[model samples]
Each structure stands twice: as structure tokens, then as C-alpha cells.
Target: MTGLPMEFRAEGLPDRVTIYEVGPRDGLQNEKTVVPVETKALLVSRLAAAGLTAVESTSFVHPTWVPQLADAEDLLTRLDRAPGVRYPVLVPNERGLDRAMAHGVTEIAIFGSATETFARRNLNRSLDASIEMFTPVVTRATEAGIRVRAYLSMCFGDPWEGPVPVEQVVRTGVRLLDLGCAELSLGDTIGAGTPGHVTTLLTGFAAAGVGPERLAVHFHDTYGQALVNTLAALRAGVTVVDASAGGIGGCPYARSATGNLATEDLVWMLNGLGIATGVDLGALVTTSVWLAGELGRPSPSRVVQALSKEQEPDHAQA
Candidate 1:
């Protein structure tokens, strides 16, 4: 059996948190080897079996952008929607949304940039033009009764722009929320944020009348600050966190960004806090261990590495 963390209830943290699993989509997006649609289907099934409710399944972006997820439609067809799980797909534009809608997707996520530099570099447009682009996408999705999530990358820092201002991020995020997005996920695309920076940013959002309930955080581990920053966000009442299995994936457009906070690692910390994540830690570790084998690398998650070590050697190798 995999090991578990000791329980210690933490005050001011949510009793239960929604772990937005990004392993299938984000984890494989940056993979050099395109995972077979069947393998991705199995990964999604395993994550659902491990109790992650909101799994980011795939993206409808053009194949030129994310070739690894080119078979998003096929993956969805194979899975046929896991029971008790919500599989959200990324839709970069109206065309992508059309593809997602064709596949009967009920939830979609749109990614944006907080910094002008990243906006220009990633979207090939100015920040304002990108917002203009998202307006129609969000409006159409919401009108169709599809839940839309907006992602504000470079919310913390950008490799080209350096540290992004808290005010700018809030303003950009508020604009996205105004476009009818149900939730705005702030991303430290370069992982350069500190805990104090995280607290101040959340405070900025609060002052602007955006509460933690409508917010989520996506952090990379470049500076090894993702976990601490997450703790800060949780203290600030942000309950929805985005993580990848086996600590895989980073911003494909941003070279400096590293792997996201690992799901097993986050679950271990939450388990110790006596917080209910509805995730079976052993099952998750086993899944990630199996995933590591498929990737031809060991899992980068410390929890997965440690627990895998304690398991029978014949099982998922540590």
C-alpha cells in the first residue's frame, strides 16, 4: 500500500476543494511523443477512478498548435464521458469551440494572457485584441449553456515581461469574468511568484469585488514555489486548484516554465490537513506510476516517488 500523510486540520481552509485535473490535456500537450488516443482515454479513466471530478480532457486547438492532442475527438468518443466526472476541453477560438460543440462538450476553457508581451507572443495579438477575440467565444459558449472558464496566464510573471502587476492581472481577469466566464484561473506561467505576492494578488481581486469562489490557480514549479503559493491562495479562500499528474506539463509557449504542481503531492498535503478532496491517494499514485512508465521517465511528484517506493516492487515501479 502507498503511504499517506498524517492528519492535521488547518483553519481557514475549505473543508473540501475541487482539484481541476489537467493531466490529460496539459500534461500531454507538451509531451514530445504524442500519446495514443487509447492511452489518453485510459489515463482519464484512471484519474476518474482515483476520484478527480473535473478533468481537463483535451483541447480543440489546431493541430499545428498542439499536435499531441490532435485526436481530442477520438479520445472523447472512446471514453463516452466517465460517469460522475466532468471532462472540460480547451477551446482556443470560435473554430475550436465549434469542434468541441460538435463533440457535445458541455464545458470549455479559454486561455488568455495577463501581460501584453505574452499576449503578443502567444496569441499573435495585443492584449486588447485578444480580449476582443474572447468576447465572442465566451458569449457564444455561455449562450449555449456551456460552462466557460477563462485562464489568465502570466498573472504572476512572464518570462519576457518579468513580474506582472497585481493591478493589471486583476483588471485583465475582471475583464475575462465580465465576458461571462464562470471562473477565472490565474496562472503563474513562469512560476516566479512568492507567497506574499500571491496573498497581495488575491487581496487585489477581493478589492475589485471578485471573491475566491469564482477564482482558481494554476502554478508551475520553476522556482519551487507552487506549493507555498497554493497554500497562500487556499488561506485566501481559493479552493479550486489546477494540477497535473506525475508533475508533468508546463506552458508549451513559455520555455522557462516547468511542470505544474503534482496532484498526488497536493492530495498528500490536503490529506494531512484533514481536508476532503474525495481523492484516493493510493489509486492516484498507482496511476501516476503507470503514467511514468508510459512517458519513459520517473514521476516528478515527491509523493508519488515516495509512496511508489513503499509499494510492492512488482507493482508500479518507484
Candidate 2:
């Protein structure tokens, strides 16, 4: 919440909007190099320290699909769990859920794309079939008293099948809701959505009785509209947002996709708007820089890049 006044408050907005930091898992999943387990653990710990209420710590998917997350178990075991912060892992199936459960994971996220083409391409299942699979996972998780977050991919448009209809998105979301998902994250998988699309889709969902509290937004920056879209969601009464540190992450199935919305940028916008996300931008920058060092690459977060340059000492001083 850096850059925000102590008494800062957005009029007519909720007391705070919960930011779901997906850096540890979504951000690292698409990396070519394998981030050390220590680095991943440190990222999760740092995110919690920065005051993110919900940090997506890791994914329990097969290592073959996302090699960068091969050390998920190790990373999860090492993150320092804060008392009030939640750590959720993405689990694709029962086996993944089992692995996550064994580590005492209290929250898990299941994903299903809105379009059949994207589903078959990304998840290897039909849209209906994928939604059905989550039913059992949701049932078991509920019985175990674990909260589940379900992701609906390509809610606006898919690379394979363009322009996903509002009806399809609503159907998939309703299915996840029926399966007992605590939240349905609507993802613009390829960054093809605009503010208008967000309004339309959110309105459709609201009409279907899936109110703002039960939804989250996951947007990419490919078209440079993530922030604006986020603002739209906020106006529509949506509270939770999914972002990646340094804007890391991409859809592996969509090779041309850009990074997920940068967490620093999102924090900057929220702080300026007097919306409490509870994230410390300076600490977020440090963590992103650490991650960049681990990957041997520069961060994509504009705020991080600018702030890093500002913080560097003058060459003459050296």
C-alpha cells in the first residue's frame, strides 16, 4: 500500500480489494529456465510479507507440462505461511490435488477454458468434459474443507476460437460455481478483451446471479488494456484481481501471448485510486528484481524498470 495516504479511501468502493498474487506459479510457469526452489520459496514469502492476502504459491500439475514448476512441492514446503494470508496452488486433477493436499495446502485453483478449441488445445478436454472433471475435485476439496478457486480461461476471446460468446462463459462459470468453487477467475487468456467486453461479460454473469464477490479477473497485457479493464471491473463491483510480479507469465498454449498484468503497475493504479490492495510496491520491485536476476533477464514491469533506474547510484559516484 505504498504511495497511499494513511487515511486514503475510495468512496463507494469496498473497504479493500483482495489482490491474488500469481507470481510464484503463473509468473514462473512459462519461464524457460528452472527457477531454483529457494528462489520460488523466497518469492512466495516476499509476496506475503508485502501484504498480499492471497498468493498463488505454486502449481501441482505434471512437471512434463510445466517444467519450471517441477519443484512445486519443495517450494510449498518452504514458504513462510503468514497467519492471515492464503496460499493457493493450481491443481489440474485428482493426482495434482492429492499432491497439494499432502503438503497441507488449504486452497487450490482448478482451470477450465471457455471454448472447446482452447480446452482441447490447452487442457486436452472438451469444455463440458473439463467442467465435469472439476466436480469431483471440488467435492473432495469441500469434504476436506479446502477452499477452491476455479479459473475460466479465454473468457473474452481465444486464439483458436475467436470471440467467446457471453453465454458460454456464463455456462462454464455457473458449472464451476455449482462445483463449489469459491471464486471464478475470468481470464482474458490472450489479452484480447477490452473494457466494453469486460462490462458485457460481467453484466451477463451478474444477471446469471454470479455476483462480483464470487468473481476475479485475470488479464494479460498483450494489447495493453489490462489496467483499464481492471478499472472497469472495479467499477462493476468486482473485488479480486490476479496479477504477476514483474508482469511475468504467459499462456503456454498460446505462444504469441504477452506477460500477465504486472503486479507493480496494478498496485500503482490501485494505490493512486485509493483502493487498498495491501501490497508494498517498493518490496514488490525488489522481489521482481531478484526474480529477474534468477532468470538472467530484465523485468517487464515498467514501474520496476523505472524505479530501478532511479535507485541506481550515479556512475560518477562509483
Index of the highest-TM-score prediction: 1
lDDT of 2 at 21: 94
lDDT of 2 by residue, 1-318 (tens): 233334455666665788899988898898888888987888888888888889998898898999989888888778889999999999999989999999999999998888889888878888888877788899999899999999988898987777889998998888889989899999999999999999999999999988999999999999999999998899899999999999999888887688999999888888777787778888888888888888899999988888788778889979
Cα distance off (Å), candidate 1, residue 194:
1.0
Residue 191 of model 2: what lDDT? 95
Taken over the whole model, the C-alpha lDDT of each candidate is 0.93, 0.88
Q: Per-prediction TM-score, please? A: 0.97, 0.95
Instruction: Sum up the clashes in candidate 1.
Output: 0
Clash counts per candidate, in order, are 0, 1
- Model 1 root-mean-square deviation: 2.3
lDDT of 2 at 293: 87
Segments in model 2 whose C-alpha atoms lie over 4 Å from true places: 1-12, 316-318
